[model samples]
Target: MDETSPNIEADAPPALDPAQQSLSEALRVSFGILKIVMVVLLMAYAFSGTFSVGSNEVALRLRFGNYVGSPGQRVLERGTYLAAPFPIEQIVKVDTRPSTLLLEDEFWFETTKNDSGLTRSQLQFQKAGPLHPLRDGSLITGDSNIVHAKWALTWRITDPVAYLTNIGSKEVAQELVTLTSQQGIVHSIARLTADEILRGIVNREQMLGLIQQRLDDMRTGITIDQVTLDKVSAPLRVMRSFDAVTSAESDRARRIVAAQQERARILGETAGEASEPLLDLVNAYSQATELEDPAHAQEIETLIDTALLELKINDSVIGGDVARVMNKAQTYRTQITEQIATEAQSFSQLLPQYQLNPRLVMTKLWEDAREQILTGDVETFYTVPGQLELQFNRDPEIQKERQKEQLRSQKKAQEDAESNR
Candidate 1:
């Protein structure tokens, strides 16, 4: 309580031993060094919590083992951020760029090895399959045909959170992608028959679109960029058979198309040939129907008959059967044409005679009819218009009776003459 001087000497009355003072100083230094070392370690530990995400990457943050931020907002942008160290919080960097999966042996059906006791060099030169079906990965088409199909697909992560949460790991996601793509290719191939695929009738573009669609439907949080079809063919052992069948089908189709085209051409040509003559015949017949004058109608009738003959001639000329059928039709047409021409000429000659002398024409017509009717062993009689009608008693029974009576009288006179002698 007295002014500070002697009391301080009382509190510090016991002085340190020399060795003890050295030991105390040394201990003081050690404590200071330990404090400095601890400060440095703390600074280093704090710095270790800082991490950065590149522009092409997204960082997913989690606190206490739970994702921090909204479902979509949990992804960190390209910048530096301090996260609580290790067990307290975590950061996962996800690359959001495009990636590709090569599908070859994984998806493509392997060709059968030539186990037919062939030499190794021979098998290598000509790879003949039918080797091992169970080991081969092939797609059986709708037509029950098998084919090898290989394809490659490119994809990218679009929704990082979904990708991380749903897939959980990049490796698993990649494996899923490859498996899904294989399924897509196999499914698309199943719908197409082997012939359709080989002949290009299967729409390749549509198949690729279906692959992407399937991937999208899986909600794999990845965008399909492209699908490349590397190979689509039959196995080595069946290549020759496949080629032959394809060739035959192509030839059949080609022949069918050619026949159809030929038929069309023949029909067109026949129509062309028949048009003018048939049209003239139609006009002539129509004009004759409207005509009141006898001579003019007859002339038109003659022209129509000639036009019909000409039309027959033209139709026979155009057809696919250019040789045998055409010739037969043409010959028949010529015969018909000649007959029509003859009939037309006969009418032409008769028309003027009929117009000039009508009575004479009637008389001649009657005489002609009489001559035709009485041509073979037959009798005929004529009666003048002003004269009485003549009668001929030509009954067979009366003639026979008269002849018998005359013969009996002659026999009786002969008997009387004999008796008088």
Candidate 2:
């Protein structure tokens, strides 16, 4: 041991203070927390690019101000999607739900609101002054008549890319739609009369098609759901006159409809569904006859006769007044034929008797005739061998009785005819 040469223990480094050690440990923990916070922030930034599209919404993704993906894939449907956040990628959402817009004053008269929240036009007999070109709006009809109308438009975006690129916003799209619709209305109304416009005789579908065509040409990418004419009329000053005309027109239409229905009913009752064809055939036959073409007339008459014969043979084929008349005619013909046949048979049977006893046969026939005459519906009076110049004046009471009996007989005959039919 060389104690006097050197001391190796004395050359060792000194122990750190407790405070510095504690500070060092704290610094390490702070760095670990900061790293964790930075990771959380980065995750948040990444997830911020996630978006959810609703059922009625369409989304488009653009990278560096230019559209991304293929044409079909450019538009995103209802789902969740992710993209690079912020300046690297941008998302545009378009609502595809149907929206309605009412253009009330575009072609409507200037109106003032009443105390009850109703417009002046809604009130009865509210007069309006001369048109103010700056304030009031109106449309000129084909007849150069002034008319007013209010319209409602329902639309929705069909193509997201076109709508976003062309229209860009709802405000701008609404303006375009309004302008286009106004132009369409002006053009359509200019081609129609005021009466036609008020009566709804104007072709609304064609007008809407024209408007849609215009939109298509402009590539608006909007589909029209519907276009409704809410109100239409002349100016308030002539409202009463217009209303009178409208009411008259409505009455005329109703009367026309009723007359048509009555005509149909009469024709149906006359010959069922065959009435029209039968009438046409009869008219053709008449025309042919008027032309003095006997051959054509005869041909048409034969066809008509064949049709009638078929109808008579099969009553069920046509159930109408014509069928009933035919049935009655056939019954009368059958009765007359049967009567003639019976008389002929009886005469044949009585020929030998009459030849043997002619006087007796004559007396018997006279008695039969007298009996039939007495049993008939006439009032019989027997005056014995009178050339007495008797005045023949009908008794009122007897005439009344006879008339009643005749009416009863006619009613019975009609009932029997109907039953047979």
Candidate 2 lDDT, 153-263, residue by residue in tens: 898999989998888999999889888888888898899999888876777887798788888899989988788888887877787899888899889999999999999
CA lDDT scores, all candidates in order: 0.72, 0.85
Give per-model TM-scores. 0.51, 0.83
Candidate 2, residue 163: the lDDT equals 91
Model number with the top TM-score: 2
Question: Model 1: per-residue lDDT, tens digit, 1-421?
Answer: 6575576666775988899999999999999999999999988887777999998888888888788997768989899999888867889989987888887775454435444576534543565646565666777888888777677778888878778777777798788888777777777778888877666565556666776676667666777777777666676667777878879988999999999888666554443345445456567667766775667677767765554444454443322222334445678999999999998997788789989988888898799888899885345566788869789857577667789989999999677544432
- What residue runs in model 2 are displaced by over 4 Å at the alpha carbon? 1-11, 115-124, 213-219, 312-316, 349-364, 367-408, 417-421
* lDDT at 137, model 2: 89
